[model samples]
Target: MNDVRLYSKTDFSKCQLTQHPLYSYIQTFLNHDISCLVENCRNATCYAIEFGKELILVVDAQFQAGQTYPTSLRAQYLDYAQEELALTEIKGQKLLSGAFRLLKTIVPQKIDEAVYVGNYLVSTNLFPNFTLEEVQAIELLLNKHFPNKTIVYRSQNSFLNQELMEHLDVLDYQPFISRQVFIAHQAQVIKRKKSFKKDCKLAKDTMFDIRIDFDVENYTERIIELYSQLYISKYSKINPLYTTVFIEAMTDAQNTQFIGIFDDEKLIGVTMSWSFDGVLTVPILGYDLSYPKEAGIYRLLTYFTLLRVNDEQIFHMSSGVGPFKLSRGAEYFPEYIYYKRVPSAKGYTCSFWLLQKLNKILIRISKKKVF
Candidate 1:
């Protein structure tokens, strides 16, 4: 078995990641502290670990400083609990609200001691193939290094990481459904969905011009502003608040592709996506919400995104906009965060056990609504 080696920002160059596929992305992560680029990641520290051919990014989050769900475990579980509470309130489920309120009080302190393996701090963290031996080796390494922390692997779903999830399950990791994500295969969606066909037609008929070959560097600030308008303003501020520096790094990166939707040569919408192992994931997508809805800017962007990827590849649209994604023939799958309780950290273990139970109930009740 190959040895597991860890690299910090100070010595990341020694890992010789220049030849790696995600070199540019990893370099950006190290050069600029991830927290500065991502607002919710203030309390967490990132490290890279090399295990054979795989380069895994790890996050050590001991404090509950972030107000968002992605970086803070407390926030992650609470967000769902709160959503469930709201649903129960709407349905007059007063009996369940008390239990959820208790969860709100207990979850914050208990779930804070965690170290996430394979965390990219993005919407999705892509993984390379891992043999059972590799999984065991990495588990052992994490257990030794982070003895008092709950070991976690975030951004996993059966659609993409079935084998990895199975391996973790075999190793006694508890799987908690974090959220439901939508995935679409372009050829299939195009063939089966009438709504998708209409969207494509609308995109073609729309006045906005979609440009694949443009100076992405020149539009960094605009991209950030547009992205913030949707993701931060319209949506919850809990989402990663990406900056111009992050946009610049993405444009400079070899692996990512950018598409701009221009209204009379002015960028109104943008998407930054990357493909790995024949699967495409768009981490950044935003448009001018101020634009009239009749314009169908969002619809146009989605259609162009489908056109951007190969017909054979699957597009992981990520979570949210369930109705919109479903209209385009996207299939929903429960995304999970798998974790192993450290025996020494009994407090976190008990809290995680309780969280697991809560998640099971929440998953059952909100399954349809979440998608």
Candidate 2:
């Protein structure tokens, strides 16, 4: 028989997660709180849900207006209008901005209440084998517990979680393409791609040394700094702002490896890879941007991490840098966010429906553009 067990912050000790593979990583959030990992989601509350043998993390948040992108429904769906509009190279930029401003006005309605299943605010949420019965059970439990909140499942793609997504779709959940992600199968990436071979050669011939074994304790601050330089400073600030505490806990977690790139004695690049089932994802990676582009610090880091993917493991390279990942034989797929509003959320029906329409339009627009 399939059953669902939910564990809140106060009752976390009652759950038996010691035998779970991700116990340590999950405990890190429970111990120091999730705000240390994702600063924008400080108001979010997390819970652990056990369905059969699978353990899933749930993040519930009441998103406020003007909240940053990561945890904000308005920012992701409505604010993204600016970027989506830019892709078409339309002539009237100010008009598009004005339209977006008008749309943002309805963002703070009842749509703010959301419950994200299997959301760690990471690049991908690796799912275990969830039967259809399990999905239905979990959905029922979430609907009962979260009442008027929108239940969401993020970071889903056809390549990795096709069956799971199909189950949700059949259950009447609306699918929205959140972003495009790259996944490299070990067989295809290692055997077929000539560019991958070249990347491997470049990685080996690079002046920087790749060190798999390092004292993470000594370099916790450095890791945060390097990661911030790329993810926060260069990329959008909406990305998770990981602190030293998160880094320290991740280093000590099981099935997780942190690789460091050294230029002589100075550590210049860092990448951390974690695996579950047969999937491996490098959620944390960064390098010193001061180095010339020719240095290939990022390339070296990617190559070394790709090497960790064994014969059966598929590497979830996550989103962005489509051309680079494509050259290395990574297949692109649209990652989706599947959501369903509870019956009590009828007041926000129009707002939710508008977001869904916008998401569909964005997906259609993105299909024409490469990446």
Per-model CA lDDT versus the true structure: 0.77, 0.78
List model 2 lDDT by residue over 1-371, tens digit each.
55798888788787776778877777776666777766656757788898766677888878665544545566666665465455445445567567667777865556768888887667678888777788888888887887778888888999889999989989898898888888888665465678778777888788787899588888988888898898778765666777887888888887798999999878899988888888989878999999998898888888877776677788899987788988877888988988887765565777776677667666775686645
Off by over 4 Å in 2: 65-70, 80-99, 188-191
Per-residue lDDT tens digits for candidate 1, residues 1-371, read: 77888777899988865777776677778788876778666777778889776687788876655455666777767654465355333454565667767877776475667888877777777888888888888888777777778888888988889999999989988888887788887666454678778887787688888898479989888998898898777666667788787887788775688889999979998899877767878888889888998898888778877765456678888987787888887788888888887776556656777877878776776564743
Q: Which stretches of candidate 1 lie over 4 Å from their true place?
A: 80-99, 108-110, 309-312
- Clash count list over all predictions: 0, 0
